[model samples]
Target chain A: MDGVMNPTTNIISFDLTTTSLRDVNHYLHHQVSPGNHIDIHHPNGAHNLAVGLQEAIAVDIHGHTGYYAAGMNQLASVTIHGNAGAGVAENMMSGRVHVKGFASVSAGASAQGGLLVIDGDAGLRCGISLKGGDIVVGGSVGSFSAFMAQAGHMVICGDAGDALGDSLYEAVLYVRGNIKSLGADAQIEPMTEDDQAIVANLLEQAGFSHNPNDFQRVASARQLYHWNADAKQDY
Target chain B: MCGIVGLLIKNPALRDSLGALTVPMLIGMAERGPDSAGLAVFTQPIAESDRKYSLYSGTTVVDWGQLIQALHQQLGGTAQIHTQGNHGILTANLSPAVVKPWIHEHYPAVHILSTGRTIDLYKDEGQPAAVAERYGFSQLKGTHVVAHTRMATESAVTPAHAHPFTAGEDFCLVHNGSLSNPHSIRRMLEPRGIHFDTDNDTEAACRYLEWRMQEGDDLKSALQKGFEELDGFFTFLMGTQDTLALVRDAFACKPAIVAETDDYVAIASEFRSLAHLPDIDHATLYEPAPEEMYVWTVS
Candidate 1:
């Protein structure tokens, strides 16, 4: 009925110790506006914080969060000042999510777009099946990372655990340190000029100072897409 | 999943509010594990030359006065019992070993939560808030406190199934993960005359630590042995007479955080559990690496 609403500059705060998780999520779903800032205190390991948001609002969680915090987001950016539990930012579609401390299992699982950054190490299965988003970890990542990732980019400044990439697809992965093992249909790929540019840009965006040249790229071998009678032994 | 909270106050000035401060921490973790809750408060050692034994009765009603009188007549010593909710702490002028075996023989329905000079343990199958209120957690005065909220993964939801499992005299442990080889370990310990009350895996780990310490191993070495001998994921918070220790499995599948300030050293399964702590903003917070054992002691 009218021109677009002016970008909101209001800051709203929710104290989790006094407010219910349902009320917080309902407020984020209905009251959030573009450019609005939300601060959540005493998150106290509550689950599903700031989930399913599409606005370009910013959420700053002051304490640790439980599973699926900021899961399946669109344009909203979320920052956890403390550690995150399992499935954080799972199936996220767009915008940015940053974890200042460590993350439990499946830190950035199946995100399709935007950047997911962890300042500390991420537990097992990080960035699993990430569709198109970029993930950058300032520290090491646990085993089975980037498993079945279809698209996007991942940069680890520290070591990667066992099976760095398992059955991954078009997504490009770069790690500065050693990988314990590789999953089926995943292998190391030579870094080209374009790969360096992509990793450098992602690292810069994620606020990491790691040099792009130190990273090794990995991708899917593309060998298991179809069944072969002669390759039955491999199966 | 489970929630663990422990606070070891370095400053004696904060001793009086230890229980008040820890009640909120344990209650704050209600969402993590709501099936049951427990707390072990290590109070300042009393001046009296008596032994204190914390006991629990799962039944809704019990005659605590009669039980205490009977215990006094049998053990031939003066006894005083304090009852809170479903638990009681009995102080008697008798050796703990003499009183413990007598309780086990005469009062099989009564569960011995802890027996120590400074620790009083309370636990039951209920919400965290209810359990804390039942045990007067907010009013307890202690030098340190360790608590747990159990979600009932490996054992049935009962008063005896709660955590803060006693490791040895004046030592206890709370665990957050399942043990893969508890049966084998229990078999090994049973032959060594170690008794168990429940089949819960954590009790096995607790008894194992007790056995190791009995064999003259220090707490640090015994926890290191836990990493070598125990399999599966775990993050353990252990409390002794004067120190608190935390250790994680090699894979560290569980989550844990440590925060320390000038007044106290605190550990919790999550940072949220420490948010309400005093001066937490100024506290140094970090996650311990896998297989790394961190200990804090108060003099």
Candidate 2:
């Protein structure tokens, strides 16, 4: 709505009700000026919307999206005004992706960078196989979340389903609510003051009104990283 | 991977737009499965004595007029036939029990897709949008609909192998995952005199439920039994005369989303299929739990 004579701030709009997903992605991939603000209307749960974005622009999608929305995002900020399907921000790199509504399974699976924020609940496997990325969920997440998470930080303000983190790696998991169960190699660890501060900052940035001090940290025990002849009895 | 979609309109006002609303949902799932697509729409039932059977001929085109005339003469009942593309829907006042056996005895080439009082099924091998267009789905009138797009994992790519497998009278099912023990299940059912039309695993699952339902189990209990008896990754959308049901396996490997509004209850393999639904933004949306079955019946 703000396409004035600023030259750098151009506004392009794509109405998915009349256009196809291919056309919409093509325009976003090849036909946008740098630093431009793009508006997507009537997304209507279409999958793979605004994926592989490599610009420093801002996109506002005004409706629900299908699977892998904003996937492989790089150096761009994408916002969804409605719910998101599975793999909302899979493999996101830099910048931020925000979902104002709920998200389906594997919200941010195997992301190397970038920030993913879900203002509502995220379904099963919320952040599986996270190479590196910051994930913040305002509400709860489903079972088997953060499975085999490699690095980065994941925060959930609400409850978590069964097996919150299974075979977790170095990623720091912070949950403020109850956990149904912890997965193998995942255990709750004492939170330090620095960890509390980090959680507080992430919550504030994600617009979640919760006390970060109440969060618990879960990390891998690291016993399975290497074989130990002495530990064979425990197996 | 396959895509499944089912919509049950609770509000009568939306009945006329059932086809219009369902086309976008089916087309939205083009990426999940593009091999073949099919749909089953349930309109209002006519007289209790009348039966509706949707037939599919494997060949691209066929002259169904002679067949319909022969079927009417054989059953000695009045029949009305409507042909669309290679699919034909015949509504006759004859019982499916009588019509099915007679057709099979005389015409071994014709495939009876589904027989119900209110259901009409149409499917083909192609893009979902094209398949829907061929059936004129955007203009059909119905209160509930279930559709599928198949990727040909368990069977060959043929119109006969398309989804929405009919289980029994006024019943059909669509699947998104494969069964690991279909051959064994088929073996078990063969001795009991159960018949299978296609080699697809989904047909096995559908026939299993049909057997269970024949033993007097409701749709919910039949699916509950399915959870224990059948083994494999599966998300099933089943439709009966007045009910629409969905069930997912315990592993939840297959994705499913359910959205409910005052007007309708919609289920799809993903949310994108439900996005274009009316007032969906305000509708309560969530994924069905593992090993859980959801059934909605019309009042």
Candidate 3:
């Protein structure tokens, strides 16, 4: 049995296939310091695996993870090799987190910073109230995604959920797949050359295999900010 | 998670005295982050000499009693050190770098989280109000401040995992969402030498903005780039020393409402939170669009 130690600049591996994840996290909580590298192998559907870590550490989850996998993260690199449960990476501040598989509901809800990448499908309310940061989803997103979003950009490679970009302010939505419908005050605009270039650059950065030219763009009408009491009569 | 309240005011006296607002705000959001709470208010930028001394030996970590004694001895009796649970806030002639390293060395078990020019972090394990009272947030004062309450569903419930995280020297972020692909993004940014702390996705969002800002992009442009680059559902709010920015995902799954008038602009996760504000004349409140951002600055 490896005894726990103080925060050190070392590379540690937390393999859950053989041992429990709680023990690993507990052991690492005291021993792992900022600027350390921690690799978690065979997570195997663990819940709330990596919650609050303040150290500048690196964590790689090898297998699928349960709910709230990486919530309230500060400065750390957490990578999930498989799908994530609801509220994955919730309320993250600084650091980078990556998910290679599908994501459940409320993904990146009210996220302040960092870059969140989902290579697979995303569930509901993705990027809701997103103040800042970037979210790149390679697959389709479920319903009510980005509802009442104040800021940030959401890129969808597959179909989008209902009420997409509803009540949005200045964020940009780019979708490569078929959009079921546009949400309130959300309009589909022509992808200009610049828009296409942006999509291409994002695709390249996300390592997406798809062609950027196929994607479309959606944005807020900016009319909601100036609500015309008379305009309501038209509706 | 935890709670944080900070204010920036034009009047130093008012700024220092206006800390009372933090008490209620922290109490209101107590359930959101049931950890510790802290408050900080700065009248102006710290002096260079004070900043220099605060950078090195002055800000060493110590217990509440010891910290108070040291503050009194080193910076005279003007320093204020407030502690609650495992978290606390110290306001004196000190720099963030100095305070952060001291916290790390002495309170290694407690998450130092972040330190900024005008912002100080303190958190433990309880409701926001409890934490606030424990840290003497009721006495804080500033023109503007931000706080958070945590519900630890997505991440671990530790003092370190709190909100109102610092993105840069003058920027702080609060969120209510999750990042879908944090690993790949982490891999992408690691080579760039950006350091990260927690495993949560919010940090990734902060790093992304820092990266964009470092590349000479303004807040708006950097946020736009963030929309196209990052993945997953999210609703976020960011505050700089001078500006406040809000963003929602393309799908717009979560809920965020904005209320604005000629005098002030108010935003909250639920509309009820804003209904009690005083003198909200000619207010127009509505939900933000998906994949959109709303920015407010001092006019």
Highest DockQ against the true fold, candidate:
2
Predicted complex 2: CAPRI docking category:
medium
Q: What is the TM-score of chain A alone in each candidate?
A: 0.94, 0.93, 0.84
Q: Give the alpha carbon lDDT tens digit for every residue of B190-248 in model 3.
A: 89877777777777887788778888999999999989887886777776656667888
Q: Give the per-residue lDDT digits (tens) of candidate 2, residues B23-126.
A: 99998788888999999999888789998888877664667898888987767889988987577898888988889998788777778999888889998889
lDDT leaderboard ranking:
2, 1, 3
lDDT of 3 by residue, A181-235 (tens): 7888888988899887777776776788777678888988877888587775753
Q: Alpha-carbon error at A16 in model 1, in Å?
A: 4.4
TM-score of chain B of each: 0.96, 0.96, 0.75
Report interface Cα RMSD per prediction.
2.0, 1.7, 12.9
Q: Give the Å shift of residue B44 in candidate 3.
A: 3.8
Q: Which 10-residue window of candidate 2 chain B scores lowest in summed lDDT?
A: B55-64
Cα deviation in Å at residue A24, candidate 3?
50
TM-score of each: 0.87, 0.90, 0.49
What's the best-to-worst order under TM-score? 2, 1, 3
lDDT of 1 by residue, A1-235 (tens): 1112334645677888688889889888887789988888888778899899889999999888888999998999999998888889999999999999888889889999988999999888899989998899999998889999999999998999888888888888999998988888989989999999999999899998888999999999899888767886943
- What's the lDDT for residue A72 in model 2? 98
What is model 3's interface RMSD?
12.9
Candidate number with the higher TM-score (2 or 3): 2
* Candidate with better lDDT, 1 vs 3: 1
